[model samples]
Target: MSSVEIKVKRLNSKDAQFKQTLLSSLSLPMADDEAIDLAVLKILAEVKAKGDEAVLSFTKQFDRLGVSTVAELEISSKELEQAYQGLSAEQKNALDIAAQRVRSYHERQKIEAGCHSWEYQESDGTRLGQKVTALDRVGIYVPGGKAAYPSSVLMNAIPAKVAGVSEVIMVVPTPDGARNSLVLAAAYLSGVDRVFTIGGAQAVGALAYGTKTIPSVDKIVGPGNAYVAAAKRRVFGTVGIDMIAGPSEILVLCDGASNPDWVAMDLFSQAEHDELAQSILLCPDAQFIEKVQASINRLLPEMPRKKVIEASLANRALLIQVQDMEEACEIANAIAAEHLEICAAEPRKWAELIRHAGAIFIGNYTSEALGDYCAGPNHVLPTARTARFSSPLGVYDFIKRSSMIEVSEAGAQTLGAVASTLAHGEGLQAHARAAEMRLKK
Candidate 1:
């Protein structure tokens, strides 16, 4: 098969202002697949109306699995045991190692109950305080695609478990009546309460709205395709959801010291994820840029998904030559890449300079892929420049804190006048009267 070719051209320094223009202009040429959207929506509505019957029909229609009832949708312990027993020793060992690292990293995020009180002499006999508590139950969605991501299952499930959430539910897609054994094993090992074989917007909708079979959950967390994102958006008010993720992306800030081959291979790490993935390089040395571009071309053919990488690079990839490292950092902060790789001489110093990014990989050895699989940092990251405001999935995502303010009778009297004055300024007579009544009591 003839592979797609990308021509690399040297950028002229005369167009310095155009550097930002070119960098900002780079984006994936993803034409929306509206047909898929319409089909998914119709299936989702049908599932909501027909419930389990509709789910079964779509399973057979889209997944070619003749699962006609909700009973079949549920994976039994025997099946899970069989899946675990079926894995090779090597695969089992790899999963064990990955889970250990992920669990250890998230264990540190656990929270403890907190309380505070204040007392003051106020001519009133009233007291008040606030309390915070964990949600009763939580849901996690793991995407079942070309390959099952055991890593994702760990990332989503472990945090909720640590957050003291009572129940943790996980849902994954199984195409053609097949589910990845590794994925099943991951859920089993992660202490997941229940694992259902459903996916896409319907799975999200079912979790959000609750069907006769699947119980509704307080929050849903995980990563999925565009349809899943849209479903999560629709269900936001009814239930809480993790951020809507975007395509994979990486920004490498390198100088002349980095190896061009290592850099090229690092770019491929995210490009393999999706055709829309973006890989960018910002360096002061023009010659280094050419070398890395050459390395990319040389390494492209070796990749199994070279066609996807080619298309990704042709559209979203960029080589930005800036005036210096400071300029590079400024540009990087503006983009707020999901994965920021700093390959400068003193990378620790440069890495500290970065203010906005989902995760940062410093030095040549700390490749972005390490964090994706086993570095213990959550791989379910914020994408589409959301790093500027949002954050990676962690224990904080699962827990909610209520302001705990308690006042003794004296404290109420001291605070009453201030509260009443503020409420009166806001033009709410009832609010001012409420505080005055407390004072009188």
Candidate 2:
């Protein structure tokens, strides 16, 4: 489609209603999908009640694979090894490099980032600290059927392994009983303990509430379609989960210096993920924006996934005009974009101003795609403005901390009176008495 015909909803920050318009356009109505929720709730409820039977039943119904026993669905270590061994030399080398990089990053995160125990003793002889512990088992959900992302397996499973999680269970849908060897190879490289050929809400439910065959996991992490997102939300209280990811997004802030083709391709990179994925550009120079648009139109027909890119650009993508790079950074923080690219003359100068973003891709050479595959940082990131509150998955996500408090006699004597006073003020005589009992007579 032509740039004019694309209708990507271009806006200028100079407009009075710009803020309202931008946020309104940026909104994703994921919560409004009641049909998805209803289906997810039923699947979750069935799995909770019927266990493995429900999982197998849904597997056959959704994936068109009829399996009588859940045992038949389980993929063994021998198979994972075969999948790895069966890869071509080039494929194995790519997996090896990505796995090592991801592993090294998480290992550093564990050692340098306070993943161990620490204690401090106060003057009053009261010891207070934190005891860090990793989860016993975790599940990594890798999306299957449509596409296979071996990168996702490394990103999700390696961190759990680094954090000392005992087992990393994996569930990937094998539609029509057709499994992706690359995904299985990735699972092998990442040290995932088990693999189950299942998908959708049923897989999530099985992970959250252990079935007769599949043991329950402490946490679940990875990305999936709409139904999978809903299942994770529903089973959150039962099992910890990575953030609820929205459609992929990348915001490129340019200073009118970078090549228009590069900027256009960067936008297309995210747009090609799906029609809902968003790609935006914030530039002070209107001419640069026009160049990027022209590049987009010229390059559109060349993309294999051009149809998906067109819908994404037409629906969610934005080509915005900002006052300057400073204003661009300000708006970037406001949007809290999942992937923020400061493709400016001095990228760091603008990136330093960004307060909220899942991950910042700095300079013209640093593209969001690099972060997805081999970058040290986890690709499973916060989305839909969640960067303002949450964070990317890491070694930290696989570990939990318990508060340690040991009050000495002297500390308890002093603390008791304060506690007693507050407890009595709150009309809890039992609480006051309990504190009073701890005081030295």
Best by TM-score: 2
- State the TM-score for model 2: 0.96
**At residue 216, what lDDT does model 2 achieve?**
97
- Please give the CA lDDT of all the candidate structures: 0.79, 0.93
The CA lDDT at 205 in model 2 is: 96
lDDT of 2 by residue, 1-441 (tens): 534356667999999999999999999866668999999999999999999999989999999997899999999999999999999999999889989999999999899989999999999999999999999999999999667889999999999999999999999999999988889999999999999999999999999999999999999999998899989999998989988878999999999999999999999999998889999999999999989988988888888898999999999999999998899989999999999998888999998999999999999999899999987889999999999998889999999999999999899999999999999999999999999998878
Task: State the lDDT of candidate 1 residue by residue for 1-441, as single tens digits.
Answer: 232246643343348466566555554344675765676677667767777767666556656676667667888767766777788999888888988888888776453323122233324544344444567788898888666788888899887776678888888888876788998888877778888888887788778877888888999999888888877776788899889877889889997689999998888888887777888888899899888988887889988888788877776777878788888898789888999999878999888789999999999889998898888979888888889998899877777766545566676676888899999999999999888887855
Candidate 2 CA-lDDT value: 0.93
Per-candidate TM-score against the hidden true structure: 0.90, 0.96
User: lDDT winner among the candidates?
Assistant: 2
Q: Could you tell me how far off, in angstroms, the CA of residue 427 lies in candidate 1 after the best superposition? A: 2.5
Off by more than 4 A, model 2 = 1-5, 29-32
For model 1 the TM-score comes to: 0.90
The weakest ten consecutive residues by lDDT in model 2 span: 1-10
